[model samples]
Target chain A: MTYVKPLPELTHEDRPFWEAAREHRFILPRCRDCGHIWFPPYSSCQKCLSFDREWIEASGRGTVWGYTIMCQPYVPGYADEMPYNVVLVELEEGPLLYSNLVGVPDEEIRPDIPVEAFFDDVTDDFTLIRFRPRNRTGE
Target chain B: MSKAEFSGRTAIVGIATSDFKALYGTDPERTREDLATHAIRDALDDAGLKKEQVDGLITGGTVHYEPLAYRAGLTDVRFCVDYPSAGRMCPMALMHAAQAVENGLANYVVLFNSLCFRSNQVKFGMGGGWMGTGLLYDSVYGMASPGAQYSLAFTRYQHLYGGTEEQLGAIPVAFRKHAQLNPVAIMQNSMTIEDYLAARYIAQPLRLFDYCLVNDGAVAYVVTSAERARDLKQKPVMIGGTAGRANFREWYVDLDFWADACASMKRDLMDPLGVGTDDIDSVQVYDNFSVSVLWGLEGFGFAPKGQGLEWIQDGRIELGGELPINTSGGMLSEAYLQGWNQHAESVRQLRGQAGPRQIPDCQRILYWGLSALPSASLLYVD
Candidate 1:
């Protein structure tokens, strides 16, 4: 089926990060001066405010920082996918990203569980990072 | 921390709010302007003043200030401005108005926030897709609404601090109890912990009751210099210290749950005001989501950091408890006038106009908007 959910409107600031994601490379902006890597990609380093920064690939491993089950499809295109989990993953590299938790039943999801990211190519133009349990029966 | 020069220099002299019971598709449905003009006239009447006396006009939430001033006959105003939408902007608006009143820029400032959900379909945290919230990220995963964002914050709060669903349910239940006393509160139905738990989730970790009411309503308050406010018909609620407002756009709430920031504001800004939480009689934390109140309690020092869930277990925040919170039902049961209603409730509380919900001998009230930026609070006293 075609991906009907909303897609991130590509912008000039974060194009490199998304383009890298398109290549199945989970990357984030890292400041050369401050050694800080942040998400939702900013043009400069969030910590040092220095425009001197570079995009670096992340480890794609993280724990479920927090999550909530969408009991209702408040917006369009998610009615069929009702009861899905909207999750925040705190990356091993120390940035938070919003994604869905797959390969784990909704009933079993809990906080601080080990998970690794996998690129789900929703459409030809975009690839979303989703997470699944490193061990299926892991807590 | 609020500017020292403007601290306690201005006062909220009169306040009024439109009825949310008359929502859209009901008889006498109101548009944005109708509600704005009505609230302006009523607030002026409440202050025992006339339209001609309004020298400053400040408005917010999609209500353009120029047209609103024209409708209210605030023709020659020294200060005429409008803030962008969102309940968080309410306290910031009050701050600017107080500065104007203190610096002699305006003798009287009439500030208001009016939102009509009936006429405009202001979607909740659902904006970032093409409109509000996120610029390029988040929406792709359907994480755009304020409720969705707050769900993450609340979930993180519990995971790091240790809390339970039953503990989370206590907030909405308490707000509903207070709403029962508010004559014009929208959600008059009684709520209990069981009811809160049984309620479905709009977003996980936070139940349906945790979200605020989105209704059509207008809240207006007349502001004046403290010297002028003393002569008004109503007992003025003097603006005291302010825990200066800050905007944190970080993807996740910091580990301290904003406690460190609140502490900095207290030490640098509010400490000089001489009236901390110890002197407060009532509290109105901006309850955009019931969790925001929990954040306020802990961040504002009412409860030990990371122990808000347990602190509110008793009736500490109820109408007659050690410290009353959201006595006018707040946004949960009260009409969601953005964050304006809480400020109005403080004014009402100090003036002994809250009726059955009134806190007796209430001389000092602390109201803050956790929903705005991380937080901003204005301490008001009679």
Candidate 2:
């Protein structure tokens, strides 16, 4: 079954980040001048205001900085996925990303827990970056 | 300019709110403009100023100021502006209007905020996908609602600061107690800490009580120069000092940065007001979410870092405690007119007109609000 959730509308600046997710590869925009890596890809470095930037591949491993279990469905598309965990992961490369934590129960999730990225192909055109416990054995 | 130059330059002479009870249910018969008109007329009457005396207008959350002025029977508006920003910018709007009156661009200015969320069936979290820029990252993950966004931040605060659900539960419990004393509050029943804990979690770590009520209503305040306000009907609630700051870079996505944003407000606002936290008789911190109030308490220098929940647990923030907070129920129990209602409550406290909820000898009060981008603070004195 295909996931019927609201998908990201790719933009000119953010296309590369979403395109990499489709191929199960995580990429972030890094400032070529200041060496500042940031999320939600932008044209310039937010720190140094430099337009010189490059797409750097991430290790796909991070610690859970914070998370919340959205028990209520604020959006209609998420009605079926009610009571889902939205996790903020601070990547080893030093950029935070928002994604879902899979392969773990709600009770098991905690801050600073190690997690690795895995792509869930929700539809042919869209793939979502999800996370799972790093210390757990093969699924 | 020196601090004394800005202190008591302008005053909020009159304030009013629409029928909060009529706002709870669907009011298809009334439009947002009607509420604005009602509040404006009532405020002018309270000030004992004729409608024609209003020479300036500042409106929030909507862009019906021209029609609102017409409906309120104001024919002479020298200066008019509209701020479509969040409720947190209410203080900023007041500050701008005060500046206008002080500069002689207008003799009298009115700031009005109104919303029909219940009647319009507006959902705050839905609609705006990512809301542009840095917020898109969180939106893609289904972290859209302000409640969920603030929950993530509050959860991180608890992790770093050693807070507990039971400790945070004290906030809504205190707010409900204040609400019971306010006849106009939407939630009149007192709530206990146990009731707060038992409530279901909309966003983990933030229970139902942590969120604010979404009833429809409007609030308006009339502003004029301090010299002119002295001649008005009610004693003027002088605007001592006002300041605003924004986290222009990461914006709302970073929870840890909010403390710094608020700290900037302290330096810019509190210093100019010439009053320390100890001097304030009461406080009206924005309670869009309960944790924001906790953040305000610490960020505004009432409590040290990692000690906000402790301050609440000690019962220092409740009515009759060391410092009373949100004596009119605030956004938590009162109708959410953004932060407009807070301004009205602050003025009431300063004028000693709060009736049963009045703080003893309330002469000075602080108001703080934090929207996603802009955070503002105002010091009001009698």
Model 1 lDDT tens row, B57-110: 888857888888777677779888878786677777887788788878888899
Highest-scoring model, TM-score: 2
lDDT of 2 by residue, B239-265 (tens): 887777776543354556367877887
| TM per prediction | 0.93, 0.95
Q: Relative to the unseen true structure, what is the C-alpha lDDT of residue A64 in candidate 1, on a scale of 0 to 100?
A: 90
Query: Candidate 1 versus the native: TM-score?
Result: 0.93
Per lDDT, the best of the predicted structures is: 2
> Judged by DockQ, which candidate is best?
1
Q: Indicate the worst ten consecutive residues by lDDT in candidate 2 chain B.
A: B126-135
Evaluate all candidate structures by whole-model CA lDDT and list the values in order.
0.78, 0.81
Off by over 4 Å in 2: A135-139, B131-135, B249-253
